[model samples]
Target: MGKIKKRLKNFKAPDALLLICILMAMVSILTYLIPAGEYTRFLDPETGKEMVDPNSFHYIENTPVGPWKVLSSVHQGLVESAGITSFLFIIGGAFGVLNSTGALEALISRTATRLKGKEKLVVIFFVTLWALGGAFLGNFEECLAFLPMQITLCLALGFDSITGVVIGICGVAVGYIGGVMNPFTLGISQQIAQLPPYSGIGFRLVLWLATLTVTIVYIYRYADKIHKNPQLSLSYEVDKASKYREEISSNIEFSIRHKLVLISFVLAVIGIVYGVIVFQFYLGEMAAVFILLTIVMACISDKPVNETVNAFVNGAADLLYPCLCVGFARGLTIIMMEGHILDVIVHSLTGVLGKLPSIVSAPLSFIVISIINLFVPSGSGKAVIVMPILVPMADVLGITRQTVALAYHMGDGITNLLSPAEATIMVALGLMKISYGKWIKWFWKLVLLWYLIGIIACIIAVNIGFGPF
Candidate 1:
């Protein structure tokens, strides 16, 4: 009993995130089990009508035939989960190999060594790197590789590790939300809405820059605080610093295989840039190309081909659990839509707040999305569900779709830093040995501050005619 209690006592923030997610899933399941009216009707997208079916066990109007139909729907969830997990795994593995080969380490070391006297500048540099990486790469999971390096840089500059992780993750989260030309979410969402292909790039680009600036400034101020008073930082621990230093010093070898990986990585970047600029490949297709390139590079490195394949497979496998969790979360949305819960919630909220001006409407949009995030974590998927409703609502209130989009982005990005639904944040908290309560205690203030800034920025942008009509 004592041993169990001790173990629970030591449970970290990531564990808490996982626990919260599981609890949410349980709630979702309970909601499904409860009897609800009008859940028998499924909407026909093409006909713009809801079709009712008496049978709960059979298919009707191409929607799941009944509540029990979700059993078969699990297959669809598994397939989608597998695809996302596998992709994340491969990307994460490639990033891990790149780090193991010392490319990432070398870069971090060189940069950190040079910026010894300018800690605030270093923070800005990492914020920029992570922001651009998220915008161009469109892979949030891969930020895991860069995170430890940022923590190390922060420690080297006498700052807390939390500072680095928060800043980097926030920057990436924002970039992912404000993705300018990202094919995954933005492209797919626009396509679903029948918007012209990439027509909103100009607006997205401006929003991206504005959000990036706010993030950079926020991080710089925090970094300045740590630089001036390292002793006061919550994340500062002498033993932690010593341990990290020892690890870095022990693994400083720069092998020829690393050089090959770096060269191939450079070529892959050039190819992606060309594809985006010249061939105009969508972000998802571009990601496929980059993953292929990384696989080839891994094979060509000093590691045996079979070993490289195994490494990649192992990497991909790591993502399975989180991916499934996300899918299960999606299942809740499926259930809600079928159960008329979505309409109920949407109808209630819209009825209450549908009459506000753009300024109030914008912030309310963010709040609604943030609340929704508790149930749906996938930004792209959530956008599909929320944007259709919010956009039209915004239009009725004389707000532009772009303003609505920004609200969606802010809601999505802000909660990611604090939400248990975000698996990557859980993974990161686990890696850092930080408790969820502790991390929230440390970061919630920053998250709230950034959320306010982001909301204000969106309002300002909309007023200045930066929104898409």
Candidate 2:
């Protein structure tokens, strides 16, 4: 009990739930402080997409949400975000069903026994696999389905939960920020900027490689340090209480049923990747695949239907806190939209960026967008909102529009690891039971390094006139 208290002390921020409520209140107050304004949106004939008119900015009547409405917005946020909310629930329940078969455990045990001395290799392999998914597929939220499994694998290998988190979440985040071929951020931003799809691939490829290299090295060192001395881990106390540790054992059996389950798991994952790339499957489709996987696993293990249902329910029950975190985070966006200050904030920031000289503006574009990401966490959403204005701004300032897109993508992705406004990130933190403060304490230095890399990439893009424009 004393040990638990010591671990709780390391969580320097308020509980995740309280911190979200505090954010809700703060955004509500901004509804009063910030003037209400909006930009007119129009459909782009070229892209068939709705985009903000760079010229339209007008004050609207202030609609400051009071404490009562601020409180009520939580339900509205959940309703507004019902698709993703349901997606989390479905996946949680599905994974719950999958966990009942004992296959995941036996696989983890067998693999851990064989790879006992090659822990670093395991980290590198999984991190790289996740990075590829992010870089090529624009995968962030989808990665959550694998977080518990990855964390378990790391734990079985005698590393900490933070190590699993870095492997799963941070790996994907860096890949996303690199944005080499990510259709969501880089693709949409390019189309909006009037560049051919993937026009400046060479530069982005180099940037992706550079950023990923740094991420891999940093993650490996941390994993290595923790593996050597578990006491050195920041989450040492929290991890000690985890049930996953109990699954680690040398005498674990790897039965035929487990092998069949493992094969089915691999095939299901492969099918998901194929469906995502070939058919553009989103959350709904991915959820269906997981449900199918769960059923298949249950059949292979010959688990009774009643037992399976109970396991599914129990598994989903575990994810309630994370789901609430996501819903509350969505409420923050709802307040901003209702207050009509979201556009005003963007317009104001762009006006400041427009005034800066070209050299300063180039890199500063990255910094500005990074700041903006706090409010608009969606990459494609920001592309439509900010790109239309930035395109012309880049032209006037003699900065390549490609550089502007690079700035947009980099700025859009790097901060996701820390932003409470991001649903998936908050979900990841909730799953790991890590506080935002402790996350910052662990991740800030690496994020700063990524920011520095982004700044330098911006400067290089500027000096070299990166473009086929």
> Highest lDDT, which number?
2
Task: Tell me the lDDT of model 1 at 49.
Answer: 38
The alpha-carbon deviation from the true structure for residue 277 of candidate 1, after best TM-score superposition, in angstroms, is 6.6
Report lDDT (Cα) of residue 25, candidate 2: 94
Q: Give lDDT tens digits, candidate 2, residues 268-365.
A: 88998899899999988988888888888888889889999898888788778888888888888888999999899988988898898878898899
Worst 10 residues of 2 by lDDT: 243-252
Please give the CA lDDT of all the candidate structures: 0.61, 0.85
Q: Looking at candidate 1, what is the lDDT of residue 79?
A: 65
Q: Cα deviation of 209 in candidate 1 (Å)?
A: 4.0
The CA lDDT at 12 in model 2 is 71
Task: Give the per-residue lDDT of model 1 (tens digit) for 1-469.
Answer: 9999999887654445355545545545655554433324566476343433322222223222254645544455556555455555555566545544556566555555666677578767767777776665565665654455566556756677777676678778767656675554565445544466556567667667877887777677777887788776655663264323313342455556666777887787677657755676543654586587667676656667777667666655544555555455445455555554543454455455587777777777778777777656777766656666666666678776666665666677667766665656765664455567777766766677667766776677568655446
Query: Pairing residues by index, what is the TM-score of model 1?
Result: 0.69
In candidate 2 the C-alpha lDDT for residue 269 amounts to 85
